[model samples]
Target chain A: MRFRGRALKAYVVASLAVLALHYIVPYTVLHRAEGFTLYAFWSILAAAWVVATVVFVSWGWLER
Target chain B: MVRTIAEFLATLVIYIAVGTAIALVSRRFGVKTSSEYFVAGYRLGGFLSSMTYAATTYSAFMMIGLVGFAYATGVGALGFELAYLLATLALLTVLAPRVWLMARERGWVSPTEMLSDLYGTNALGHLVAVLYLVALIPYISAQMIGVGSIFEGLGAGFGTGIAVAAALSLTWVVVAGVWSVASTDAYQGLWMITAALTYVLWVTLFLVPSAGLDIGRVAEAITKAGVSGLGGFWTPTTFTAFTVPWLFFAVTNPQVVQRVFMPANERSLKRLIQYFAIYAIIYTLIVTLVGLTARALTEVGVLGYISNRDLVTPTLLLAAHPALASFIYVSIVAAAISTSNSIVLSVTSSFVRDLYERRAREVRPRRSITLANSVVASLVATSAVVAFLRPGFVVEMSVLSSVILLPLAPVTIAGWVSEGVRGVARYSSLVAVVVGVSTALYSAAAYGPKKAFITTWFGVPISVWVLALSTLIVVAGLLLSRVKPHVGR
Candidate 1:
């Protein structure tokens, strides 16, 4: 009853996606690019969080 | 002494200014009900929640112990910060929603009360209360040492006494009270970003190009200075430290319990999580870079690498620009005050708000508890003094606190995981605490210090590994508890 089946799965998926990006996005900025490394890294990191939220909210169903 | 004077006065100003802002807002915006006082009336938006969480989470240590760790250890120290990435996101997805739901449903305002109120058991709740108090005292001591250290380091101009500075800080805490603490947190949170960004920019413009420092050059300086000169910083090292312990703070912390009450709904909760994580990641990365820049500048022959790692950033600022250093100095104090006040308010809430009020049950007037709250504040102060007197005692105690909190992970899991959990989860968490503490003490005695044998899978501290195993045992016990059929329903 507590699981909320699809909802919990969606939550887990979003979290993993964000953490996964956290691990790699830094590497991409540090190794893959030349200009604006810090800014790139910062924007990407913040955006991953944004994307994660989108990933999470996409799972919501209309209650009314 | 002048340094201490400047630091103390600056800290006092920031605290008063920020504290008053919180109080005014709380009253003006209508924190009329107990929920508002206790949990900001559960009306917090994502932005406020994110800032408060960061302010409460960072504390004096981020400026001191954390920066110090980076100063000494290099980027390899970042494992701690990185862990927070994993932790905070998890808290949003998992922990906060449950805590809010339970608190609202049962009106269970405190962690200790939630146990008995929701579960209908007093012994389990009381046991948790004891554990919480034990875990928090050293945390408070960590902040005390932060205040005391600033006092000792500054040394001349302000005519400040350690007791005087400490008292002034505690008074600021009493002023905004809890609401004030939150308000100040929002302000301090902004201050932290500004300080971090300013340091990054200042060092980049002044130190980096002039000294011919680049990423490779930074790495080279770190390598040449070896562990001793470079202070052992490397990029990976800095990232780890920032992430790890923060995971605990963001996800599992009882301190952030009130945060859950603030968000308007599930949608807001998700947004707050993302906001805090992104901000923390960005801010931490900047701090890590700034720390590396400090190493490079020192190695490139501009400044000296001071003995205390945390002092490196502030010390560097002091050497570079006195006027700018003053702001950083005050911000550091603000950071400390914001964090310490959060802890103080948290401990006070659990003690005076939960333990005291629950026993009385009758709608005890808020004013009646003022004296008790004062006593609790004094108790935290006394423990801090004791730690200051023998810092070694606090260091040992913090190691012990790590051991103590390990059990809570399972205890909380049980509370969330099962409706018919019964006594098994409760006893498991308590047992784990005792076992983990005993083992941690033995390990500390055996290994001495700074030699925690980290495991590969989690790289969790040895004490935490002990906790993980204990939690597993609790899980098994949980299974057993549920497996057994109830005789009467």
Candidate 2:
């Protein structure tokens, strides 16, 4: 249960990265992508989340 | 009308019978101690832990509220909900392991107890418990509202719906405590996912064809709706205001936070997060599509006008084939009862373990269980009454709950990473809770949901203001403190 310093550091970085992507992708890209089906747009957005999850999980595994 | 009512009743009966069976089977697992009763003795396997977490977290909001929101607001709704999911995953990655370790090592049953033990102050725990009850009661009530509105939309009386939801919620928790709640939650979780998939398929295969709605044409129409509704509803400020508090939901909300203590081991914890993330992604996508499809149908004149956003799903269901509608109806009921029972169990545990037990000495396990059962019953009854009053929209009620609970985020973060700032953190949390709750109440009262943010300072909503102010105060307290970190017990 000890808080591994490396894990905490990696988590912060991944969180910031994910959050920044979340903000940028929706506002910049998807918001302006006219005529894209909701499914198509959401699939891209879900991909962003998948990438974020991968980053988080990889870092967690490495730290562990 | 009679046939619809009969279908609804039959679905409800089947759901109750299944849930009761799960609870009865779970009860066979023995509950000799308060900890065992409240947390399944921390022995939940990965599947049970994951399903319970998913069920408790998803709630009726996904099918009913989120569908309505997406129908009304378009892709912005997806962004807001996705942001929550991402933030939750991030938080779980960093915090869950630490929380699990502390709980296992310290024998902490509630997050409040963990905070109190971390800060070496019982008052902090009491304050947290009180704030949790204040915030969560409305949220619990919102579930009842979800159920009531569904039934009302399907031609039954709202009062009957609320009563039925409350009775089912009370039955599961009162029967087997956390064991029952978790088992029933797992059962309900499966029901929810299956129902959601079926719904999406029905909408795509049957509804889309029947309506003659082209996906590309619907997308074009959505894009043409201009800034207010579909295309540009998520102005940055509005999005931040709505999403900031929810980003911390996994840690701040006691029901999910307490689940951090329930996994059997580290592997179980990891599996729980993995399972929840998959469930959340699939469910969010399905519900969002349901909303978009509903909107498209309305645009094509296939579905009638829906003036109230919350009625989007229910209205569609009412017009759907009876059997399909009945299954989805049962799923929504499962969502409501699963969430309500989990909240009841968690709140009851907080009352007994954090508040009552902290004050009294030498209370026996039997007495504690009896007291918890009484509290659960009372809380459910009170929340059902509140639901009968029908205070506000489900999503708005949930956001208000998150806003009031936002102050706990900084305290939790500081507790983990900081040293020797216990007094500062404690007092800052108290101040923040007071100010945040007051501001939220005043805003809600003065303007209601639509205009609630009209009176914002510097163009930011009161929720963001509360979060910023609370974090600032906590930072200031940390800067002022000079004491060394207290060694862990």
Candidate 3:
């Protein structure tokens, strides 16, 4: 089966959470940080997104 | 580091010759049908699929536009570009499988055909095909302009640059259609990434330390420049305006959406997304660092402050090894040609499959392929002329095209997610596009494209408004039409 029921909800919630952190952290947490810190934070986020995507697809959550 | 025009032409000629040979050789693997010509008969493996997708998506915008943006905006440019990467990965993971399955089952050639099939209307396809022409021609012309700028920098006339770019784009597509384009795109994509790696290494290993600075000092310089954090032009509103349209690029952009139909199977499609995610992140960081590095150099008094952000990369090139710089320059040309040719091929698909085929009853496979080639040639020529003219609004029009295409997001999402987009929902797709495009055009005319893009409605950028309004229209149509919930593709 595809991402249905609990799996569907999980995917949506996780995506929304990551997205929220992406937007909110820049202003709330890193507002006064040096340029390098901010850059590292984003780089970490990018890496995490790549890992998550590979994991999700591997789990067959993205397929029908 | 100053190179003669003859030297520049020699590098470009060798690059073009190698690229042309790759494209020409690809014809042996080509099929004869229009579907084969346009989409490689939906048989691209993971490497070619991912490479073409990367090359087509990243354009001259990366090394030139984004580098400059990063120079001016600091870490915000990284955030903005990463937002796009993140969103694209999420969207592709969800939508690509469905689109690929459906296209394979139904033999859909054009992206418009898929939408038209889902919504049960040729009208939508025709309208979208026309919209593609209007929006993408300027974008294609912009790529040519990028090439012209690089050649002009090399002391070759801008006109010579544009003519060469136009000629290459036209020839590649005509040689074996998408087979040739994809083959050459894979080659160019390698060139692009290699150039990027060389550039980043040159900056970090040599340029920074030669200026009596290390990573720590560079960070200090950027921090002191006041571009390290979110303020100034990186204001929330401005970022929102800049990012919203780009976030939906996977769906709204025809060239990329068509790529969803190219990968040979489920595995290839998945690989395309995964590989592209890796490429996108790497390229994004490289360009962002290039910009920030330039800014850091300036702050430490090693280089002059470049007010025109676009010129930052060129200025930095002056200090680099001459051979390395010229390779990067050719890579920029490769980037432009790869992107422009893909656009030409895709727009031709829409023009032929959606518009022309509707009128010409029983267009034989050979005839349709011939017609497609003609359209590709015409598009290249027209874009070349537009690039030569160097219209003032070309850049604005290119940016505005994304905003104009915002309505496609809702229309496409609705078609894929719902069981059937029927009744008023079909009309809703049409209405949404018209309303969304008209609003964007009106704002561009009233406030000018640049200002209008950033113009906020209640602290929300106009781009967000365009998306919200388009979504609202689609939702209303769904409710009124009572489309059944989607079970699965």
User: How does residue A20 of candidate 3 score in lDDT?
Assistant: 80
lDDT of 1 by residue, B1-489 (tens): 366456556655665565566656655555333455556656667677778787877766665666666557654444345546554666555656666566666765556566565445666567666666666676666666666666566663222333543564466455545465566677878887787778778788776777776767766675555522212233433344234334455424566755666665655665566667766776776776676667667777877767768688657665555546656665666676666666666556566555566676575455534644585568657755765574565755653454456556655655664665565655665566567556555655676423332322255456456656766766776776773322101
Checking candidate 3 for backbone clashes, the offending pairs are none
Regions of model 3 farther than 4 Å from truth = A1-8, A61-64, B1-4, B487-489
Best by DockQ: 3
User: Model 3 over residues B322-356: C-alpha lDDT tens digits?
Assistant: 77888888899999999999999998998888776
Ranking by TM-score: 3, 2, 1
lDDT (CA) per prediction: 0.59, 0.78, 0.88
lDDT of 2 by residue, B137-193 (tens): 888898888888877877788999999999988989888888999999999999999
lDDT for residue B13 in candidate 3, whole number 0-100: 86
DockQ for candidate 3? 0.58
The C-alpha local distance difference test score for the whole of candidate 2 amounts to: 0.78
Model-by-model DockQ, in order: 0.18, 0.41, 0.58
How many Å off is the CA of B443 in candidate 3?
Answer: 0.7
Least lDDT summed over 10 consecutive residues: which range in candidate 1 chain B?
B227-236
Of candidates 3 and 1, the better by TM-score: 3
- For model 1, the TM-score of its B chain against the native B chain is 0.84
Model 2, A36-55: lDDT tens per residue? 44446556656666655645
